[model samples]
Target: MASKKNININLKVWRQKNAKAAGSMESYKLDNVSTDSSFLEMMDQLNEQLVAEKKEPIAFDHDCREGICGMCSMYINGRAHGPDTGITTCQLHMRMFNDGDTIFVEPWRSKAFPVIKDLVVDRSAFDRIQQAGGFVSVNTSGNTIDANTIPVPKADADKAFEAAACIGCGACVATCKNGSAMLFVGAKVSQYALLPQGKVEATERVLNMVRQMDEEGFGNCTNTGACEIECPKGISLENIARMNREYLKASLIK
Candidate 1:
């Protein structure tokens, strides 16, 4: 729906050639901008212009164009993904901007998430943390069990689903002043803790993942709630509380 109207804007985009390179914000200008373009689409337009001029295109990550993949992440105007609620960067529309506006875009900033490119960071730290133990450990023998065999309380199921909605986008980490991934880790913990299939390994999973999370050089969460506020999935602080309890119980058991 974005139509190129007579609008002008300024962009301050973080540019880096590689992980070891010193990064800095490079400014760009836009003219006759479309108000309905998604933020990524705007970047695409910019890339087109740069290509035509035989200049290097800005680098960023994206896929699904929709918000589900959690791949498109950018710190826009000071917020993770953008100035939007319950949406990822791909879903962030240009309509959020105004004419003659100045927009700042940057990659996720975290010690564990080293910069991969201009506006992309290697978020594989999350994968490592998950590998610590974020799954149900059971060999698949193709035995189908009745859904009713393990009766999950409605409340727990709902909470599990809510926590499961986290897309691992690292927005919580990016927005947190401490660069804490407690929200992300908490959601993962809560998702497994509340599920019947995951209950068997709940104690071990929480302890291991939390340990890996701490070892990743991320800061401790002080519960500022900025993570929940900025989370596209609206994952709650309650998940963090649940994770804390699970971790304590896990420690005691160990």
Candidate 2:
């Protein structure tokens, strides 16, 4: 761990006001940064400096500060969530950087996700895709079934849990060269599709979700594997293969 000692660094951040506004990258210099601070904390120090200089502060979205919320979305130095593996941006520490280093930070970039502000893009399109049938439609009746009523294979259960871990952070989208969202959509599909409860509407769920994903203008997946690499939750490409299989089966059956 790096100490709380101060260091100086260079920052290049992308700025955009709204979807209609043309965006560009802007640079700033900072000094006396604590090496032990988290990435967001470093950004806070930069914002404070800009404020003191009467300049518009750089805008970025963050919540919970913990790794759980998946709200800290940043493309740092050409990698989503910085250069760390299996960690969210909030978990990224300034210690990874050296004094006088130049860092480039940007928002999630995808046609489905348009810019809302400087480092904030509209990601509600994912929510809309989810609403388009990302879940099992069975209403919860008062009749509670025992857990043992259905003996799910442990393998299936484990796979379902893995898929369900997707945090919908949009890193997969940003890191993708084509900006495809197969990983995100695939995780949701695999999460429910593997479960018996979701098997009932499996065909409809896969069909509707993929269709909506396409309608959102996200590019097609070419299996570049950038998504799986950048995913903070470490979602697998296997889930995407599962989704591909499910979609094929549904299309053929229907």
Candidate 3:
């Protein structure tokens, strides 16, 4: 094993007192940052410096720094979840930048994702969308049948699992020029639509979810494919196509 080298860098961080307050990019310098440190760890160091100086620390959202929580939302250097691809902010490393590089960190931007503070946005719209139609009504009583008894095609099963991998991070929406959430909504819809247990309410589920997504004021997908490209989970655009089909079928049947 080799010792990782350390370097100094400049940070351009967003600071906002609250949702109603004005925000701006504030510059700070960091010294001897190790390349091995995760991006969030570097942020912790920055906060430590601010607190030591009696200045209010930057506020950001993060939980389960392992990247599963999807709560660590940051737009860094004009890209969602930093400049990395297929990874969340927590997964980004200091090594990605050069010693003299200046990094800009901002919150996810969208009409649906209002900034709650510096580097933090209200993502509860996703929760509302899920509440609209993200589940299967299962009887948990003793009369419930075994899941294995109903065999599903391997292809559908794999695809459903892939769609289920979405962590509900708003990167797809942030990266989309139109601020569209089609990828996120599509993944959620596809996860259940491909499964037999989800077939019962498949029609209603897609319709309600899409309707709720629109009501939240997320922009429409224009098929530029930025959402799929920047998705941390690599959730496929195929899910979007599947969602469109489901929505069409539901519209016709209704």
Please give the ranking of all candidate structures by TM-score, highest first, separated by commas.
Answer: 3, 1, 2
- Tens digit per residue, CA lDDT, model 2, 134-242: 9766556977676567888899999999999998999999999999999999999999899898899899989999999999999999999999998999999999999
Model 2 alpha-carbon drift over 4 Å, by segment: 1-4, 141-149
- Tell me the lDDT of model 1 at 125: 87
Model 1 lDDT per residue over 135-172, tens place:
88776678967556898999999999999999999999
Show the lowest summed lDDT stretch of 10 residues, model 2. 138-147
| Model 1 poorest ten-residue lDDT run | 1-10
TM-score of 1: 0.96
Once fitted onto the true fold, the runs of candidate 1 whose alpha carbons sit more than 4 angstroms away are 1-6, 144-148
lDDT of each: 0.90, 0.90, 0.93
Q: Which one wins on TM-score?
A: 3
